[model samples]
Target: MRILIVHNLLWAHYKASVFQALQHLVDQQPDLSIRVLQIARNERSRASLETATDADTPTYTYQYELLFDRFLEDISLTERAQALLRHARAYKPDVINLTGYYDPAQLLLLAWAKLNGIRVVMQNESTAADHQRSGWKELFKRSVFRACDGFFCFGSQSADYLIQLGVPPAKILLRKNAVDNEALRAVYEQTLPNRTRLQQSLHLQTNNFVFVGRLIEVKNLPMLLNAFAEALKRSVNALNWGLILLGDGDQWAELSQQIGSLKLTDRVTLLPGRPWFRVPEVLALSNVLVLPSRSEPWGLVVNEAMVCGLPVIVSERCGCVQDLVHPDETGFVFDPEEPDKLTQLMVKFMDDLVDTQRMAYYAQQYIAPYAPDVVAQEMLDGFREITN
Candidate 1:
């Protein structure tokens, strides 16, 4: 069997880990082969998010191809479609797994696959809660979904959305997303000894609620600051607790101004986004991980934090919340729109009302099943089921 996966970025280390694991599985099967065609290096807006400074090459042990050395969005739609089609025709895969349905260039390849009787698998991270449903877009997506042989979703939320669109539940191959937990945990453990020195050098408090991601509007940075301020006002341990904002975006100046206006400059620190591997270094010095995105499909940061044994405070709207976060167990989930609710959860952490160590243990255990190897095996099994 020949399987070809169409992915967007070569610098997505998390995806690379899964691809590596999948390749390892395929190698064990003498009759199977898998290759990934990375569309671009990274998106323009997300250039800062990448740790690699070069043309975004794969560092893992896998058979893959880089179609372009630049961002795909910079390429013309016609050029992209032509390149994708050329690669698909040359490979003549028994099955083609699309990254998502958002890209029309990939959709053209999907259409061609259907006409040629090649099995198609669609991987979706978008949930109904991520955006407002459009009747026309729904109609178009239903047509697209109809051509696919199987589905791989981010979580239950995403899988349920496909079911609502009339897809049979049996067709949903995988409903969970994962990161390289063992790799991330190893990095975190290596950085553990230097946690004290790192925190002291940065002048960060020993116990802090850290938010790591793009400092954009959708991340709800303003609300995070406001909620942290409110929690400070209500906590006796306010002096010992702090907020760490990690990542760079266009909203830096505005977020800085808001921090000043809220009189939180001394308590809040904004750091530039670093590579995925270095995230464990940041998580080492922090006590809790917080993601307050107003609209997040699946917050993978939560998985990274959990792997490092740090409890998370994620938004209820995030797709990972239902599958990974257990309310008051692994961590707490608050409504992003409700500042007061977020403030209360923050206070619980600050006041030591929640058992951080206990919750952290639960977090690590809950995240074990969502490892890259598990997800890769599921993908392989799904391919076999469809092809046979």
Candidate 2:
């Protein structure tokens, strides 16, 4: 059976890792063959995250075709659609996995596949809580969803959203997502010995809570800063802890102003974005990873943090909270709207009220099942189940 998977970005190291593993698995299974069509080289917003990955050193290697070797936004809808259709028609896949319903180009491909009697799978990541859903948009999504034969969701939250839209539970083929856990952990382990020196050289505190990603408004950085300031005020051992915002965004000036207003200029440090592979270096300097986004589809950074053996503090609205955070175990989850709730958890970390080491151990254990190779196996199985 031939499977053609349409992915939106070639910049996704994590997704590329999973595809690499899938390549190995498909090689072993003589009955299975697959090709991934990367829609674009990278999205403009994420280009900075891959700056350090040398072109010659392709750690993000997989058997894939690039439909557009440029930013997704720079490619017109007509160009994208024509390229996708041209390649897809030539490949003649028995089954096609679409990126998502939001992309008009992919939606057009879905329509073509339906007309051609090709099996189609919807790969979804959006959760119901990601944003306020309008009725018309939901209705439109339902229409597109009705055309797909199967679904592969990022997690239970995504699967639940599909069910809410009238999809049967049985149609949900795979409900998992993963990152390159082994590679991320390897970098963290290699940087472990110099963590203290690195922190000291950087003038960072002994313990730090890091927020890594774009400084976009949805990340709720102002609220995170407020909560961190409050936590520092309330914790007696606060002097030993600090906060790091390791990303650049449009909100840089605004966040910087807020940091000054909250009198946390010294307690909080703003760092620029780095290549995803180098994220473990920041993880090494941090005691915990904090994702205070008001709405997150699935916080993959939590997976990265857990893989690096650091506990996470995520907002309840994050889809990954349900699967990754285990209150007082792997980490804690709080309502983003409740600044006091977030502050209390931050205090617990600083006051020695939480067992950091134990939580770190459990975090790694909890993420083990979501490793790339494991998820690849599940994806391969899902493809076989659908095609046969």
Give the number of the best model, judged by lDDT. Answer: 1
CA RMSD of each candidate after superposition: 1.8, 1.4
Off by over 4 Å in 2: 55-58
Candidate lDDT scores, in order, read 0.91, 0.90
Over 1-388, each residue of candidate 2 has an lDDT whose tens digit, in order, gives 9999999998887898899999998888787788999999999987766675465333855679988889999999999899999999999999998989989999999999999989999999999999888789999999998999999898999999999999989889987889989878888998989989999888899999999999999999999999999898899998999999999899999999999999988889999988787888899999999999999889999999999989889998998987889998999999899999999989998999999899989998999999889988888777777777
Query: What TM-score does candidate 2 reach?
Result: 0.97
Worst 10 residues of 1 by lDDT: 50-59
RMSD of 1: 1.8
Q: Once superposed on the true structure, which residue ranges of model 1 sit more than 4 Å away at CA? A: 53-58
**Alpha-carbon error at 104 in model 1, in Å?**
1.7
Worst 10 residues of 2 by lDDT: 52-61
Q: What is candidate 1's lDDT per residue for 1-388, written digit by digit as tens?
A: 9999999998888998999999999999899988899989889888777664444233678888988899867888888789889988998899999999999999999989989999999999988888899889899999999889999999999999999898999999999888889878988999899988999899898789999999888999999999999999999899999999989998999999999999999899998888887788899989999999989999999999999999999998899988999988899888899999999999999998999989988999999999989999999999989999
